[model samples]
Target: MKMSQTQAPFARLLDAPVTLGDERGRIRILYEQGNVVLKRSSSVQGVFRGLHRQAAPSLQEKIIRVLSGRIYDFVTDPDDSDGVIWYREITPETDWVHINARYAHGFYALTDVEFEYFCDGRYDEAAEESYNVADTLRDALNLGAIQLSAKDSAGIPMSRPVRRAGDN
Candidate 1:
């Protein structure tokens, strides 16, 4: 829900995810000379060849939720095998946090078959159930209701990425 623009080094940005308590979230941070993008979805979670009782959040929701407070319009990845849904959030913020809640929750809850079935457009009931679960998990994680660190009983409060060694 917080947004900002920053100029920093990649390694310094890398340490941000670790410090922010995403050790288990498997987040990947990408950077350019002018912007930082924190990615929290794994590549493995996106593919679908079948469906199960559990489904991950659609790609559209992931972008909308993480980059909150922006107006998002629906878009589609025609190149994707499943035609992965995407959203274009209109905003000027340069730094972003991208969490694939569906993937994160589905990685634990859904089976490959379920994923495929959802992709095939056969199981709306199951997909909705899984989506609710994914949303709940993402909300908790985003709001710090789920603590990623044992040492920090209160959860990781949002803060600017702390500077580390090698940082400019």
Candidate 2:
């Protein structure tokens, strides 16, 4: 069955049929504008029959923005295709204490290797999402804060400047 735009964003699952059932009742799948044949096993049918529509929340962009500020910026080295440079604000405070420095002793080599991995698309479909996420991170860093419309436990919206350790 095709889900309406008003429904939760489940573009991939739109093709799936809508099922309706209860704890102690037989599942009845309501047919929509399709001629699909149900040949799956009862176990598989039971799973979807007991499924409930829910709204999935997405906060990846906000999380990435906040995390980006806590680390250095990385870029592929122009001179060497297999080299990358991960450098943060060169201040007296907060140096050499890199986030992922524990695993890799040399930050330069790690950054370069990671960039090569990115170029090969080892991660998700990063050709586009990577740039968009990078842009969001840059904006968050430049603005000094991740702008979000979330509220606290007391129902108060938070809008404070992000500060690192030992920041004046």
Candidate 3:
């Protein structure tokens, strides 16, 4: 389903059909796209990962799916005047989320979780940029005391300029 146009950083949920199997696990086709890279992440409860994105020339459009457990997923456009942060509660049963390349993406694991995403572009270390979730979305999230990786802990504050490799 599409979100309102008034929302900054366009994103939407995509429906997937699941085929049930007798005495076996189910099969669900999340997405099918050629030349996409797949990434998987496993996070324990109370862990927060990202508000991360790559800059232009290496930007990636992503399709995210929760393989197990639950999370509060978020996406935002750093350039938007309103600084709007769009979020949703996602689970294995939820529709997959498609986020445009311009938005930064992140999630807070509400329970032990395993999730995967398909990216249209390869990862570029020099082009990576991230916002400090604690600094940017602490008040908005209100989920006390989340853990962050060292790289994520050192993320740039949203109030400051986001610098890419080629920026002067």
On lDDT, the candidate that comes out on top is 3
Q: Which of the predicted structures, 2 or 3, would earn the higher lDDT when compared with the native?
A: 3
Minimum summed lDDT over a 10-residue window in model 2 is located at 112-121
| Whole-model lDDT values for every prediction | 0.26, 0.23, 0.73
Per-residue lDDT of candidate 2, residues 65-166 (tens digit): 111113232322222334333333322233333222111111111111111000111112221111112222334455342211111112212122222333
Best by TM-score: 3
Question: Per-residue error at 168 for model 3, in Å?
Answer: 40
Candidate 2: which stretches are off by over 4 Å? 1-4, 7-64, 67-69, 78-86, 89-168
Cα error, candidate 3, residue 4 (Å): 46
lDDT (10s digit) by residue, model 1, range 57-155: 323233322222222222222223453333233332423323332432222211111111012122234343221122233343332222222322232
- Tens-digit lDDT string for candidate 3 (1-168): 122343545764544433332221223334433556666667788888888999988888999999999988887798786666667888999877888999998888888887888889777899999888665455655678788877888887664332212211
State model 3's lDDT.
0.73
Off by over 4 Å in 3: 1-35, 159-168
